[model samples]
Target: MLTVILYHVIFVIVVYTDTGPPYNAFPQKLNFYYFSLYVIPSTTCFFIVLLSTIFLVVKVRRNQRWRKGTSTQTAKTNDKEDKLVRTIIAISTIFIICSFPTVSIFITQIIHKQFRYRDPYLGTLLLLMFNIGGVFQAISSSVNIFFYYRMSSRFKKVFASLFACRRSGIQGTKPSD
Candidate 1:
């Protein structure tokens, strides 16, 4: 991952040299490379998360059936596992929902070379879509914390403790009278 990130940094530095207003006006080949760089990994991640979530759900259901007659301890473990699986599914679903717009826009732009240039109305619509996709991307990246805090009691405790420590440090105790 670090290597990939470094490569992308280098590539962006090399390709995006013009410090001008029309930043989107890259050459065709560079544009293709940039789109591919974003689209491939995002699409791959989406599919992998989707497939793994499905696999986990199926496995959990099968295991639940097998462990129906197990002891309370085992049932408790299964409950924890079920909560984990549900959290994962929720996260994955959010990812898919959030990423769909960006992915679709990239694919559309790739296939339709004149997507943002063909018609004035169409170009404006595409620009709107692009902005909306950016919003979704931001939401997707940052919303995981909310899910963890809401779904996991352990996460809530740790999160609250972190803030509690900060607040206590900021407000030191008064001296005894």
Candidate 2:
């Protein structure tokens, strides 16, 4: 929950920072090549994370049932359902934390007045790391189902119940009391 909020705040900061006239004017003034790789790819990752995380979470919940009057923290002891929920949480966490740095970098450029941009070589290296991290975040979001399989007990129970119900109905058998 906090992670989600933190990511949202960082995302907004990234957008408004460095994107404005001052930072924009610098590159036009200095023509620094280092800013190219760092700023572009890092910024790109931020947006990709924003889009993909939303897509992943929405898709997970689209047809899923939420048990009324139940706390999500309580696992169903069914490994599958628990794994699913845990995967969702883990993926969400990864997306949020991963997005922070790239966005923060943009924000830093906007805030630090004296530096006049750090060394081009160092900046390029940092930016590359930022972009790579973002790629990992994307991959994490995409492959989260595998994590869910390994960790969530509640996910298992719910999934089993759903499948069991479906199978019973197909056979025209009475549901267990």
Candidates in order: C-alpha RMSD to true structure:
3.7, 13.8
- TM-score of each predicted structure versus truth: 0.79, 0.38
> Which tens-of-lDDT digit does each residue in 1-177 have in candidate 2?
585556566655654564554655655433333344345555666677667767866665552445423545344433445456556667666666766765675556656533233666556765676678678667756776655555655766787799999998889975799
Q: Quote the lDDT for 42 in model 1.
A: 71
Q: Give the winner by TM-score.
A: 1
Point to the candidate with the largest lDDT: 1
Pairs that collide in candidate 1 are: none
Model 2 lDDT, full chain set: 0.60
Candidate 1 regions exceeding 4 Å error are 1-4, 17-26, 69-73, 117-121, 173-177
